[model samples]
Target chain A: MTRRRFCATLALCGLAPGAIATALASEGHELRLGLTPVFLDDQSIFLEAWRTYLTARLQRPVVFVQRGSYREIVDLLNQGQLDAAWLCGFPFVRHERRLRLLAVPLFQGRPLYRSYLIVPAGDTHTKSLLDLRGKVFAYSDPDSNSGFLYTQFALAKIRERSEVFFARTFYTWSHRKVVEAVAVELAQGGAVDGYVWETLQRSHPQLAARTRVVEQSPEFGFPPFVARSTLPAGDFKALQDVLVAMRNDREGKKLLGQLNLDGFTPGERKLYDGIASMAEKVANRP
Target chain B: MKHFMRDLSLRYKIPLRVLVLASITAILVTASILFRVYDETRNDLLRHAESMGRLLANTLVGPITHDDVWRAYEIINSPFQGGSLDQTQIAETILLLDTRGQVFVSTQPTQYPMLSEPGRLDPEYAAIVDLATDRNDVKPSVVDPSDSSRLFVTIPVISEGARLGTLVMSYPKSLFMPRFVDIAQRAALMTLLALAVLLPIAWYWGHRMAKPLVRLAGCMDQIGPSVPENLHCDLSESHDEIGRAGTAFKRMLKELKEKEQLEQEIMASERLAAVGRLSAGIAHEINNPLGGMLNAINTFKRHGPDDPRTLKTLALLERGLTQIKDTVAALLVETKVEIHPLSRRDIEDTRTLVTAEAAEKRLELIWENDITEDLPLPSTLVRQILLNLLLNAIRAADKRVECQVYRDSRSFTLVVKNDGTHIEDEDMAYLFEPFSRLSRNGHGLGLWVTYQMARQLNGGIVVESEPGETRFSVALPLQEEA
Candidate 1:
């Protein structure tokens, strides 16, 4: 009996480190990527496919973390719970001290997009934001550049406060939701991301056909993928390389096609100067 | 409706009644099954919604307690995102209300903003607030307010000791309609299929059942006051009710024919008796007066008439008296019953009497005599009956005349048949009446005399004529010697 017990002990000792190593490998190499509502809401399948692609390319496990609003994703990123996040330019610039830009999504062959001011299809007379006084308005998110900051800056330039210009306003927490609000006439006017609206037009034409775009803002830096500044350089570089080289790979190109994107670029910080200046102006308004 | 049905023919009425009854049963069964399906579906949907509301309330506890409006909003919106559950949207809107009955986080934030009173959004929301705050455990209820159609289910979010909030989910009532319609359609289809199979069977059975009755009715239509002897009713042998009716009708017709024959026989005999009494009185009165006149004329010729004129007058008077006596003798038929029993020779003598007429007509005479002994019937009346029938048959026969004489213990029968033209139905009615004028070549008094003689002897004569031949049958009951 003593000999049998000794043999059993020897077998357990031999299997312990292998099990521990497998567990450590599975838990430590997983990358938790955060997605904000600025991305389309109905892209769970796309997200899954992209996660699989990323895991295969980076030689590690990957997971996607989705939140309703940009603020939640930004908070998670700031708390170091997320390895990387795809966020709007406004939040990246606002928390530039703790976050570092990893990649910028290229739309229509350039890393720039625009914000739109939309109204119900029947509102023919409302050509610009000035004509929308006393009307209900919807905004995508406070941390959204094209969805929120651009509209605020435009209102500031006209010397009108948003609270006073519109009779009522509410945050929809999503660019697609902003379009939906305008389409359903829940809000007479709304601000949305042009790229998100265009993508929705392709995917759900009947829903997009309910609203009309009244104005398009000047081009601004697209929403970018970013990492926390404290992330290891090697891990950051690995994620950046995978994103930037997506156009050169077949699987990544197909995923990009589903996302309605051209490619990704390691963009410069000066590319978001227009949004940064607009944010500063909105904040410094009297 | 009763009159209408009574007037309808059995052929159409039977199938119509069966169809109406089957249709009523099918409709009732279909309605009941559809009602059950609707009830169960509604209950199942409500139960499913309640369970969903409870699970959502539990998940919202942490978010509601921490004041994470976005997380709570995302949790409520998750059910709307996936199309995996079903084609229909489960919930129209979901709301999270704070302990103060304020809208904390909602799927439609723009409509129901944070920290706003729930009642201000819509009047119907007041019911949800009341339900959430009224009891610790909120029950699901269908609330279709005037403006909107919705079914609301509320679940309270509670921690270890605190009630953090209420999770209210309102599903559009339209979602249950598709399931109800589906079940109703299936039930209706099944009912139609069953009716399709059963309706034809009912019709066939009804028609088969009504067929025999229709045939019996046709047979009844042929029956008149003067029922024919050869009426055919094929259904009498069957064991069904209609067959029994047919059997009864046939028996009634037979009795009617017999009664009609009896009445005809009585009329013929009564007429013959009346004629006999009148002729006998005439004969008696004429004979008495003529005898006296003749005797007086004879005495005058012998004693007082010596001139030529007196003699001529006497002779004329005698001739006139003799003519009157002879006319009266032909009219009188002897009513005396003869005591001599009928012999087979008497029946044979009829053939001899009609032989000359038959020879003149080129007719073959057939004689079938079965009797060898005398029968206790009057020979004179029997001889008269045989002579009248044979003479009539010889007159009417085309090529052949038949005479059959037979006797049993009770009666003597004679049958005379002639192959001649059939007797007309109109002529046959009065064929045996005196002076009928329906005979082919002679006065119709021969059959009348034959009928009278047969009746006097307590016998009957029946005539049956078709296209092929005419037959006369006389049956005389034998009497005891007096």
Candidate 2:
């Protein structure tokens, strides 16, 4: 089987890398990770490498529950239906009382990414989010930090409700979908994840060809892997150690390279205070 | 109404038709626009309500999944507090129904949160909950049956492939009705504006269009049976339909004038033909008699002259010859009309010639002359008129014919009266008409020639007749040298 296909199947079957033989012999615990489709994008090669390396380090079966919506994945994570999830800082802060940060993926050796507001390439009217008032808009997800929450925070800064500012809006449930929707003019503007948009621009230029970035939000903490607050102490520590030390292991390094990510880091809670403050400003907006 | 419309004048009819057509078109267009506006407003309102309902359902999904009823209630009540959630005033009430159709959370807390099961709640809600539970994949939509203006949209909250509950949102059509009304008002105003602009133009156009036709009609009316030969209308240069009609009318008038002239010429020709026919017979009889008289005169002149008795006889013969020559000279037809003054002697000579015919017919001829001075007129024309009247009177009178001639400051009148059968009323109207044949004695060119000659002299003739007395009067205006 192709490495990606094998790894995806193994992930679906909850088979860890070194524990594959043991997984076949005994009933292995299923480690469910709530994932948004934006980070997946059918990149089975990278997806398999990441899952295989993580599973090998954890020495347990790892399974992924793929839902297009961030809100759904966040809710699943909050409900403890998923063992852990890689969640945006906005949703992470939203469910902070019930969720705890495990680790944050570092890109360019830093745990930070910005929010991008984009429009069709030929559009010259919208130079920023404020110019998109009363226009049709697409948001990746209601819970997405860079895609939805940052836009809300920006509008909240001007004392405007995003729902009222836009003529009409709907969620595409994924950052790549926001780009595609904007490219096709299905939406006049979009709020999307900067990391996902840039990655697609480099890897799939054709899909990003017709979209132009109108504005970017201040850099915030990159999305971090999170688990329920009530997760067992030993299990949480094991997942955290595996993610932070991934750059040292040969297979983990290879997987990290394929994912265009540096090793994971123990993200400080204060690093996410910016997203939390924005989220609080939006939630408390009158 | 139909008869009234039919009887309306073209001037009124044209404008009325334009008004009716324009009004009907305006009404139809306005109605179409209003209907479309109402339809679109209704759809937009429904869509907006549905979208709000979906948003509320998504927001409540988290709290409901966590079984946090208080948070659900708080979220449901947010719209009523003039918050951003219901700033459009689309939702009137919102209720979160558990999977069993029990109202777990509601904005209208006192009235709702009904403890009833799925089957016993509002039928539409129950139906929606049933449908959502049966098919979690399908979105449930409902509108209140009792009031169509109120929309009820139900959204199923599915968490982890399990039906958590149904979110029922109540939104009335009142939210967008004002906007619809404003649109309708605008449409009506526009239609009225169009009508206001168009109607006057239509009226003016109709008036301009009808004017030519009205003028043409007036021209037609003026063309009566006795229309003057010089009648004309001025609409020949126009290019519209009415103009075309005017042109056709003018052409017909021209033809009619030509026909009238031809008829008058024919009447004059017929009179001349009658005169020619009588002249032939009169020449033949007069010539024979004149030859005998001339021989008698010549023999009398050659045989004897010195005796007083012979002298008297020769004078008598000379007088007879002179009278005949005068009568012949007076009867000759003259083409060119010339006026002359007449003295008492001319009347005496005319009476002397007609006295024989009157005596032969056994009629008493009474002649009166009130004119003392010489009368200046077309002598030949007056003589012809006098002779024709005298003849006709003599023929009609039982035993007496009266003739009187008078002169006034302005005119000269000749009155001829006869005690004979009166002329019939029907015949009197056309009595002066050419070739008018009433009876044997009247059916000739004698009277027709008299009528024509009088008109040529700028005079008029009238015949007034009753049972026993019929009078013919001829009057001519006296024109000075000019």
Candidate 3:
């Protein structure tokens, strides 16, 4: 029974989604989240919070990159342009061999979140991913775990290709853009980050109210803090320690609260194995 | 499952069918919308991509015509350096090809001049450039061949309609997905939202549409012969076909009940008419015996007081007269016939009618008649009754048939017993009913006719059967002369 429960927990977290390498090869001590505009609606506050916390803990100057698509951030990370980044689990798993696990955020005390498949608020026809075939769709990022990878995996499970299954698909590079596009009827449906969607519901009620979640995927490993494999061991440990202990410290906790998170937990390699298995399954599908 | 469904009442069947049909319709509509939008969105994406390529070609036209490779390089490289055409949003590669189909400049440094032979360059792009250079058409063109994964467009640098050089811009297949994914995601979301809102409304509407039918079914189930008149069905008030049907059904039930009652009344009147016929037959039989009895009484009155030898004659006469009197009393029919005093000769004549038949059947006729005076009842009915009973007994007896008649001032009783086969219990239920043939096969009317005549005379007939003896007895209330 315990083993079954363990397996169930593993399955719930999508430990096996997929893995790919980031593009940027130039490496440095700069840490930036390839945050599409949606992630840093006000970049100053977001960048300040991360820079102050990381600079104080790492004893190194930390610069945050606020502009760029998720793919750009991944490319920079791959080319060693950025030292570390807050990246979605999709890219993290994609570049599993090249990236090191730093830490994952704890939201509602779980290191997990979901992908929400959304449609226009007033639409009364679609019910599942299968129903959205040949319709215009929005994805948060090509490299995003919840935003794009899960949608691909879902299509693969049914032996369908996104190009044929959907009429047109495009990445917004930001979870917020996906929501806005769907809400404004620029797109008929979208795959969005659950956390971002929830945050938008609270932060921008009117925008969030324009669409409804049609599907909530099985819980998956949260997008986490990722660093290149070439990072110094001591520096990586310092970064992990700073995030994990964030809830325990006054300044850290205050910063986390603003982000609607408790703190961070130790990176669990096992947490993403389920996503890897999913990636394998998607690869194996006809 | 199919058999079970076949048995399902329409109340459930209708809702299930409606839900199934509606669900199928919803699915079909969603699928149609999804595929239709998908086609439209993809075409729109392709169009948009082509337009972007054309716009890029237009921007690079002047530099190529001026033979400014460095300036053309700056134009393509500007978009990569935070310019309007962001690197992620547009062309992956841009090149300026000279009139000789030699690459003069490109965004990538390694490919500054032609790296590969002209044949190595994209064949479709080379072909378009060759066409523009040869024809001097110098038109911007978007060329997307189905076999290739990359999108390429060619724009010839025109100086006074003279082709100077060509600008080639290329985007990989991945460039199309971002916009397409965004649009498709929104379409899917909208479809789901539409289903969520419409399905429930469909169910409610189906229920409302089937409501009258369900109610009508309930009414049909409750209807019975004994259902009360006041059990109201107000569904008839509605101005619909079902309401009209309810009204028709209510009328049908009322008419059926009335017809059933009328049938029962007609049957009773038929039985009464049958009884009247039986009584008339009995009265006719008694008339002959009554005339003879009056003559015998007149003879006795003329001679009984004069002769010495008349005493012996009187004893024989009294015995014979007593036999006649008992027979008439025993054969008295029901009360619907007017009472006429019984003559002593009626029993004697009825016994005489059966005596030969009993003798022919080798059965002894034991006639024990006790009646000796006149009684109030017509002798004709009595005669018919006695004759029918005696004939039934003679036919049934193996050796003997006994007819016993007795009368008091208040009542007359007659019993006919035969030593013969016993009547079966199953057959006894309908023994006195009309057209009942219980073994003897005597037109199946003998006992029923006798019973009806007896009923008319205010008397009843009963039969008791044992192993070797069966007896039919009838009793009538005696009436005095009016």
Residue-level lDDT tens digits of model 1 in B72-104? 766777788787876454777888888888877
lDDT for model 1 comes to 0.80
DockQ, prediction 3: 0.01
> How would you encode candidate 1's per-residue C-alpha lDDT over A1-286 as one tens digit per residue?
1123235334433433454447547776667788776667455557657876887788776656767678888899999999999999999999999999999999999999999999988778887899989877889887899888999999999899999998767777788878877876667799999999999999889888988999999999999999999999999999999999999989999999988999999998998899898899999999
TM (chain A), candidate 2: 0.88
Q: Residue-wise lDDT of candidate 3 within B1-482, one digit each (tens)?
A: 98999987665666567666756775676667656765665465456545654565666676666544334555656556676554444566666666776665566534333323343544655555565355455666666667777766666655566666666666675655665566557656665666567666765766776677777777777777565656665554576897778778778777877887668555654665565566456655765676576577567757657665775676677677666554443333344555566767788888888888887888888889898887777787877788888888888789989999998767898999999898997776567655456645656566766876787788877789998999999898987646
Residue pair clashes in candidate 1: none
Instruction: Quickly count the clashes in candidate 1.
Output: 0
Model 3: residue B147 alpha-carbon error in angstroms: 44
User: Which ranges of candidate 3 are over 4 A from the true structure?
Assistant: A1-42, B1-482
TM per candidate comes to 0.54, 0.37, 0.35
Better of 2 and 3 by TM-score: 2
Model 2 residue B184 CA deviation (Å) reads 3.0
Clashes of each: 0, 0, 89
Candidate 2 total steric clashes: 0
Q: Is candidate 1 or candidate 3 better by lDDT?
A: 1
**Lowest lDDT block of 10, candidate 2 chain B:** B326-335
